[model samples]
Target: MHVYYYDENFMYMGEDIISEYDEMPENATDVRPKKGLYLPEYDADKREWFESASEEYIESLQPKPQPAADVTMLKKQVAMLTHQVAQLQRGGTS
Candidate 1:
């Protein structure tokens, strides 16, 4: 559920509130026709609504997993390189 506010000139103030569940109207005016209810801001860019709504929805979504690092593989590679350098310093033939 989302609650929106607007000024007299039809300018959007922003979302007043957001909820996971839907909200029912209490009074007649709440259900009555108005200019700004659920209406997108007139001065807003075309992508603005899509972006903001998407972000809000995404924020309500679950978290994702993070990838692991290859620490052992890196250590092995470093050790192999160090051995190669030592052999080179000793003038050893490959």
Candidate 2:
């Protein structure tokens, strides 16, 4: 069982081996905009995306994590507090 993805040029992207058939979108087209055509291969008994291909494709398809403004603000605050703590520690020692 193997899954294959190819670009418009028909170049192989990769392959996966799975055990069941994952339903594709009704509008699924062989042409992937940035990616390419995706094909799934499965064992005769199991009709799914190839395990390797499914895992890799699924992982690749995930959206990248976005940085949060609050997280950035918190980091800045932490840095400021650290500097203030360092200054206080120095003054207390002096």
Candidate 3:
């Protein structure tokens, strides 16, 4: 059977599968939680799974957008490449 685990604060930790005949660990339970934005936490009083999303956690999952490249820098690189190719065609050093 698959068992889910929680920390002392009831935050979901992870899961493990064990033989049905074996004794379940103190921290483990057979209650499979629904997948959440983050793992769902167990509420002992409610006796059911509850989930919540953290703004910080959601922000962390998003990648920061990269800054746009300047056209001037690209133009310089192209010019340099053109000069090098001109020298290469004439059997000169790069």
Q: In lDDT terms, which candidate is top?
A: 3
Per-prediction CA RMSD (Å): 13.1, 12.3, 4.4
Tens digits of per-residue lDDT for model 1, 19-89: 54646322101112234234333322331321223555655564754434577777889999999999999
lDDT of 2 by residue, 1-94 (tens): 3444544433445544444567433322233223432543333233223332566777788797767987899899999988889989888632
Point out where model 3 deviates above 4 Å. 68-94
Decreasing TM-score order of the candidates = 3, 2, 1
Taken over the whole model, the C-alpha lDDT of each candidate is 0.46, 0.51, 0.80
Q: Rank the candidates by lDDT, best first.
A: 3, 2, 1
Candidate 1, pairs of clashing residues: none
Over all chains combined, what TM-score does candidate 3 have?
Answer: 0.55
lDDT of 3 by residue, 1-94 (tens): 9988988878789899899999998776788887653657787777667765678887887897655566678788999999999999999984
Point out where model 1 deviates above 4 Å: 1-69
